[model samples]
Target: MSEDFKKRITVAQADYTKSFIQNVFLQRTIFFLVFLILWQILSSLGIYPKFLLPSPIEVLETMFFGFIESDYLFAILESFRRVLLGYILAVFVGIFCGLAIARYKILDNTIGASLTALQSIPSVAWVPLALLWFGISEAAVLFIVVLEAFIPSALGVRTGVHTIPKEIIRAAQALGARSIDLYIRVIFPSIIPQLISSLRLSWAFAWRALIAGELFVNGVGIGQKLELGRSLADMSQVMSMIIIIAILGYVTDDLFFRTIEKKVQKIWGFNK
Candidate 1:
């Protein structure tokens, strides 16, 4: 390679490193620790009742001791299971519905018109109907979680598919690619980046829906634990549960999608 070309590559690498540092959440770690330190100081000074706003130390202790002494670990695992199951089902159904709407012009416009209105309804609004239809069981919880995630994903896929450049479609069609084959060879690949982005949004929706479901449904999970803390007026447990939920959400997204997202960006010659 030429010397100038090598210099360009080094510049690009430096730019990418700078972007990564700005975009990643690692920088917020110390900021949160500082916040915790301030919280502990206030708690020590008795600015508020411990039961109402427990200290950070108390919250950590509650998480450690509660899990060791009780079924908290199982509760967390069950919660993760429920969220994953609901999210998977949502993705499947969403992809089907999205593709159908995108395929048929009449349905495309019709559903597109109503999609926003339908999705705008909060996930929690379905909880009552879910209970009525499925009773006080896991189904009720699952329904709300699925409903929450499905809307965004379906919309995402349809939008992604629709947004493909017309020239690309025409060229693929000219090459004898038609219908399913066209989609497999051209459309699907083009939409993958968008699909990944949408799935991340879907996870956010599913997380919110899961908490709402667990609060009403008879289940052993974070929502149930939150309720238990409320009944006993245990602020430490409540705080700990909140932190655990936040941690899990962050961890799961990083574990499952971060690698793929970065790879896609790299492939697209975006920030990497």
Candidate 2:
């Protein structure tokens, strides 16, 4: 193919990709708007009770005025604070456990397998134990969040280390790199991408766990509001909380994980 033809093909491909992305965003916006319109129309028809199917407008209105009068903002902040604490704890514990399993054969044979098995258990399964051990308090919620976040993190680090070429380690050792220096100069950097990927997974797990954990907490929280809404058969309040949870999850994912992922991709030459 001619050089000019090749250049034209590349430019055309890029333009098409950009246009496709724009169209996708537009399509999603249209879909959401149409869905809301249909929901409003059906709910306003009065065939079904409002409690069973609230109009989108009612849900939005409740979310606005209801939250201002209630402690909705406080609930959101409390959940966020708990998640942050659990995330930090998970990162530290996961790193240590992962390194121990990866570096030592005996620990890998026992604890590593156990952790892998534990990962299969749902985060909610731990709730009973957490509540029994700590009661319906912050500790139970924190424990559940840590349990959810740490497993993926440990596994991710182990995979990253194991997947590294043996020759790279040998070459680094030959250069007199040993112990902490070897990790700092060679191994640690190589595992950063995997570590960051796990952190994203950890955040997702933590977020889900937080909501579930909050259900057990007796105090103020979004999860508590969810339960209250259910008891009162307040569908608008329930939907509003669900929407808030989704928005918060999306915002955090974008703010922390996606930002890190983009930067890492750029540095790793995966992006132009």
- Cα RMSD (Å) per model? 6.2, 4.7
lDDT of each: 0.88, 0.89
State model 2's lDDT. Answer: 0.89
Model 1 per-residue lDDT tens digits across residues 49-129 = 889988899899999998999888999999989999999999998888788888888987898668778889888899899
The alpha-carbon lDDT assigned to residue 51 of candidate 1 equals 96
For each predicted model, how many residue pairs clash, with residues at least 3 apart or on different chains?
Answer: 0, 0
Give the TM-score of each candidate: 0.87, 0.88
C-alpha lDDT (0 to 100) for residue 91 of candidate 2: 84
Report how far residue 207 has shifted in candidate 2, in Å. 0.9
**Residue-wise lDDT of candidate 2 within 1-272, one digit each (tens)?**
99999999999999998897789768789989999999999999998998999999999999998778978898888878889999999988998888889999899999999988988888889989999999989999999999989988998888889987899899999999999999889988878888888889888998888889988778888888898899899999899999999998888787878899889978966664
The candidate that achieves the highest TM-score relative to the unseen native structure: 2
Where does model 2 exceed 4 Å of error?
A: 1-22
